[model samples]
Target chain A: MNNWFKILLLSGLSFFTLGKAQEKVTIGEKQNVFSKVLNENREIWIHLPKTYNDKEINPAKYPVIYLLDGEINFEYYTGLSDFIARTPYADIPECIVVGIKNTERTRDLTPTKSQKKSPVNPEVTLFADSGGGENFVKFLQEELKPFINKNYRTQDYSILVGHSFGGLFAINTFLMHPDYFNAYVANDPSLWWDNEVSITRTKEYLEKNKKFPAHKMLYVSQADNEEKQKNWNSDMTQAIEKFKGIVEKNGSLNYKHTFFPGEVHGTVSYPGNYEALKFIFKGFRTDIKQLAKNPGLLEEDYKQFSKKMGTEFFPSESYLNIVLKFMKSNDFKEPETYFMNLKNKLYPKVK
Target chain B: MNNWFKILLLSGLSFFTLGKAQEKVTIGEKQNVFSKVLNENREIWIHLPKTYNDKEINPAKYPVIYLLDGEINFEYYTGLSDFIARTPYADIPECIVVGIKNTERTRDLTPTKSQKKSPVNPEVTLFADSGGGENFVKFLQEELKPFINKNYRTQDYSILVGHSFGGLFAINTFLMHPDYFNAYVANDPSLWWDNEVSITRTKEYLEKNKKFPAHKMLYVSQADNEEKQKNWNSDMTQAIEKFKGIVEKNGSLNYKHTFFPGEVHGTVSYPGNYEALKFIFKGFRTDIKQLAKNPGLLEEDYKQFSKKMGTEFFPSESYLNIVLKFMKSNDFKEPETYFMNLKNKLYPKVK
Candidate 1:
């Protein structure tokens, strides 16, 4: 064999090993299943939270986040999950992330496709296959969700996150079928789809529905790049703003509209998703020392947050481990013993 | 024995193989060498730009970027390089990225050992044996740089990018050895080393040096997270602002200080590096269609930019390919022939 080829093979082996050698590993399981609705096989990447272990006797049931455009976006979101949910801070609650890779992105992410091309999109054939967004949502609802619930330890609450055309599908799904998810986050949604077909539906939905689903939230973000550029005409921002206005006019709708000024289409996902998740878990605090000092307050806070979020939201074993990690870092001594004993006393082992 | 463990092993294999399948990939060759200065085997990751092997006729010599804390951060920086240098827009010029992984982070990154502890750092014992930074710089100069130059196709121009303690090292190296790198980017540099030893040194250096090396730049960034929290005491930002003020007062120093308002110390590297590289390549344009229309102007621009950068710089072949890619996207016929013909006529292949 050629030297470069051998070196390449050896490096490839090292890359996989290096990925696993890290402590807070983000190794995801990829599974393929045939979808009856879609009439094709779909590959899904599912990342379980660090706390998840089937052997730990009724370990934990986590809320699921169904991330659209997950083929390319999973790695970044996985990093976010490792930091927010699994890291020492435990800044956000733990949840399983289900990243759904796509076969045809345009077919699945647009509500009603049109032949009309926006001046922003020069490629006329880009939106050729239209009107499959509703079916895609059905594929999620009727097929994917049931399979996940059947196989994994999942809670009742779930979140739907999307970007660009995926964002359009997320918002459209929320409007068309409001009870599908607990929260819907759309980042730089392609509202220009089908001549703003989804935006028109949003106004009509607001006029008729009078109130959105209980304990549900919707967030829409617009990249400021389009608005700043002279030729782009700011259509995406305008459509999103118009949607936000309609939601606000409804009075009972829980909605937020964000604008990332310096971010363009490609760069919006990083900050956009970070801010959206922050908005979702705005009240969760991570200072272990402060929380430890006021145990009663911490208890009350979790219970109240659980009630608000419609999930049993106590700190997971992994979360308590991080707290103990801080304690050990501060020279409190033998954090392993303290946390283990406390875990036994507070939440006894099933076996 | 467990099912999850078995699944994990399979996934690991899949991940590595998948990483291999991609063409013109950013597959870094990791090699180790015994450094006499450090008295240990040091690992370095060298990523050749996509265009390096595209055309075999003595392909381009790229500027090297030495990234500190490369073990974990290399993946992110690699993605950034792919986007900025290899992507369609080619927002930044293509260059080789050399990621330097650490053996003893504290020993090498800090300029001096300090007994004094900040109230924010709970672990007082974290900074022991912390005065090896100068030696590390020596190792880079004597061993690493010589090795890279001898082995790889690299320009004399180089950049040093570091975050946190590594940032401290970057600034120290720039102050002590101005000719080592053409640009220094310090993202949220921890300037509280040895009771502000480096900061004091920075003040004294600026007073004497009169002017920074021509065309060389230094950028410092402060994140908002440290400022918002009560316990953290906002020292990083304060120190950075003071340093920025000192450089500004020097007048002739090429300096820029940026603050990511909503970003924390950990989260700052992504946007910080992105913005810093943008600042470095602010004048390099990649719009190929407009450039193709006036080919003479594009050639002249590269020459002028090369002169300004104090290095021989030219748009890489991959950069040209992306231009033709845009042309192909916009209904321009036979992009390959035009680009090939243009490449032959304009930049004649080296014998």
Candidate 2:
């Protein structure tokens, strides 16, 4: 090859390599095994926190956040989690986010079958294939759960977040299997589903069931929509208010609902998720030393608080800090013995 | 080739194309031009806002945030911007960020020559060749500026953001070319540069110059550092305070200096940028009618605000809303004569 041509080729090659080096790491080649359980191929994005791979830090387990519409909402949730985890005010424990992508979104998310025309494409044939919430829950419980447990170091705490159609699925799952998740976030659920069958079912369920599991539920609605003819947001607002009323009347339910006046449907999900996390972890204080006297005392208090709030029992950063402070405060004496005994009981047979 | 082999090759080719079709748009790309002046000869990353390239609406010009040490910090800034832009309380605008990758970071960012030995490789004597801020500024001003202007629809309001060593260079550039950028955000600047020569020079410059141009400057420092033994932050703070005192004694000057109580150097930049932008654009409300009436209003307001704050200005969504509200309110007026006359005064030759 000519010298000039060789140099030019080398420069081009260098530039190409430089570009490759600068490119952000996109989705990896690993196929999500969870997709196979749904009997469909779809992408799943998993974000392991910064501390996930550290060998020095043993007994590392993170609370998991399962997000629906993984392809669209995964980035937003992952980013929010990362931001909050790093901040001083909301120094939430590092979380493992499992972004579950959709194969047949309409099939899996819809709670009941209804004959309705498509809004985006009106020309499409008017046919509805819905009511797949049970199978979707089965996929999450039987297939996805085992896969995540096997692969990741996860704590008992778990949150299920969804929006619109996915929100319908989330609420259905919460009502059907209350023990599965610790927290549920439904951002503008299509409560208008099949003339409010889910809401009606919820009312019946609340009346019959005496004891509802402790879990945090945040239901959010947007300000304006032409769908509510009388007042722009009144229909959705009323639906949410009525749903909250049912939960409240049950006396053993925990829920929080918010109405964002200016936010549209598309934009509500991001802020809703952030606000939900903030509200769920609102009581958690970073100053853990305050509870140093008795770790069990702190846990007992948290448990009772969770029961009162109708939320799943989980120890936040403050709770963990209190444990650490108690252990270290007394020159690592009886507190250390207690922790050692607790650890031994938790992980029996481990040396 | 054999028939089976040929079929396999064709199938592979088709799959490759399919994969490409399915791939989501990643953050960074090779040789993607941001502006006419800022063409990517080397590897560079550009973050386009969500509304970018929306043809249905008139193209919105975004404030450009340029990050130093793009190779290391590009992903972080991109992630930070994405998170902040989506948050409810955070009014920071959705920005088009240009992450300028470094060729020789030490050569470019440093403002003065260094004879200090390399700590990492002390066996081999190291002569630090520094003081390249002037040439670096020229490259940014002449080459990158034109490239960005030509390719992207950008607001005249631009932010120069940097950390540590890069932070020093940002301050140096702002002092030298006050009119080049609207705001200068320096996160923990190396004010102790070459035994505080730069700081000394800054003092001298302030003493000599009577009229300082209108611009915003934010100097952030971390709590704990060995170099800050003599209360470095306070010293630096006092120096800037004294400099400001001099400027204020002479006339009015815009400046803001803050110190993070417990945050270290590495973790200060993101939060610093967030707070700085908030502080800089604290009360800046945009008037859309004013922008329409006087097209130069956006540029003028940005300049005036930055000058008032003494830091680079970043307008948030609220600021845009104010402008939009102004435009909406004024556009309904029956007589368009006032608007036309104002436009003529602003741009005499255009009409």
Candidate 3:
């Protein structure tokens, strides 16, 4: 073989080897966005739903979930959203999950500059760089959201999710800027931070506003980490209960508080996030079998759900395709035709 | 530039572009295994734990879990395993997840050749190529298991996990070859197959063997999918209840059965799998704070757990390192020294 030809052939073979070496199962991609508010390069993990790039379906917009503590929760959280949002029995609409990886976690998520001596070693100080949450939210709202909106097809609806300090940030954001997100989920939030400053903020907000904004939802999950908490003289549980009481008493906010008995602070987020999504998208699941005979019920159900959510949610083209296939496979001609017409009406063919 | 040089430079640039185009968050990789027993090529998705290749610690062996319905469950299932298995408050040992993708779903997961008329369309037959489960298990035992064992750093302990027809296979496999795996998990098993053949088999096995084998564990999860079941005249719930009663009455097998409310047939696997893992590894969690003051208790707990499990389980090098770091950071000198000794005793320096 000629020298140049041999070198080129070798390079080509190496490329193919690298490509086929391992067929990976990937959940998302990592992208960097420079936040001027935080004045740092922030890395975000973005997971698009399975059908986001499907050529068969028309381009679609999706609700974006901003998940805090990205590196920890990105993998399972993304998987979960996709799993439950499967068509024909989708509990929630397909979503885009944007996981924000932390740089200085304590600095970013805390609402107040407070420090505590380590319980195990009183000589050591903790949370030395606390209180940058307000600025963090500003970065999210001003910089990150715009970047996401510009790059991806997204619905106006979005959610904020967090755990522990992240959860505290989420609650603070909800209280400070209620209209920023449609819903908020806080799992085992560190409400006891800075001697329950978040509780004070919540009370002040309620007193001033009289009521939480309609159509905004908040779901809080408290973990039964009693055994773990016993090690430190912490009022985490009490703070959470107090917040729960306040929220329940107010009765103006769409709120749900769950106490997971067996879950610890670290593990609560797994089930907590799952429950939060179900609670937020409560009316999304429609029985496909029921739809066979009562095809008109689909539209009626969606209308009622939209009215309740204060946001319009039509059936996705992908979901319609799945429904159509189900009806056709079952030989339910009437419903099959019904769905075909619905699909055509909602997503007309382009000339 | 010269033509050859330009071509080479272009190829190099293209390779770099391909590499940098997307930084993906991957959970696992896919591999093919030719199964002589089933006479076909089968694909498997393999997920290794985070510390599997960490150069900081010695290579460790992990318990292997063979997951069924790979296409649907692999992603979240892998994440769940890794998430819960984090050190210091780890609920279960880090595991190697091998998800077997389907080839012929009905044929491979069903125990007996059975057919049913589609409830929606009586003209159509369901489960046409049923009853290849025995062969499928044979493939696992002879080909797939060996391939995995050969390729990975695997512990002796292994688990079989499945749902629906796959769940039926797990149960059937447990009855036929209890010695093959250390634990078995069945999530909403189709015990009603062929007029409750699994129930009959369960009875016969109890009659012949007198009791389930010792040291082996079985976890069963039943979904309260009554609304879905109402569409088809199914004995699924009854069969599951009957099996649960028989197993509990036996009083010999290490078993647990849980019925998850509000979960449908399609969505049951997520929570079911989560509960199954927790149930299987109930005594794995230990308090890191408790270990700080009384480090000797760690070995005592492990000893007790090992005896109960009928298998020895040492703290991994990674876990001991975490403990040591925790103690050192907290200035717990005695416990830090104790764990250092333990680490040295368990995973000695090669040099």
Model 2: CA > 4 A from native: A1-23, A26-37, A55-59, A87-90, A117-127, A215-234, A248-254, A282-351, B1-26, B29-63, B67-96, B99-351
Clashing pairs in 1: none
lDDT of 3 by residue, A1-351 (tens): 343443354344531121135578999998765555786657789999999999998899999999999999998899899999988779999999999999999999999999999888899999999999999999989878987887889999999999999999999999999989999999999999998999999999989988889999999999887865765524888899999999999999889999998898889999999999999999999888889889999999999999879999999999889889999998899999999999999999888
The lDDT for every candidate, in the order shown, is 0.72, 0.61, 0.88
DockQ for all candidate structures vs. native: 0.16, 0.09, 0.31
> Tens digits of per-residue lDDT for model 1 on A85-141?
535445577778899999998888888857655352355555678778888998999
Candidate 1's displacement at residue B165, Å, is 1.5
Interface RMSD of 3: 10.2
Order of quality (lDDT): 3, 1, 2
lDDT of 2 by residue, B1-351 (tens): 343443354344531121222234255443322222222233346777766665533456777888887755555466556555552233356678888878667777888787654332334444376777777787788767666666677877788888877888887887778778877778777765666666666666677775666554444434343332343244444443444454456554455656665444555664566566656555454434345546556667667766665555544433444444444444534223444444344434422
**Candidate 1 or 2, higher TM-score?**
1
Model 1 chain B lowest lDDT segment of ten: B16-25
- Residue A164, candidate 3: C-alpha displacement in angstroms: 0.5
Q: Residue B20 error for model 1, in Å?
A: 18
Q: List the residue pairs that clash in candidate 3.
A: none
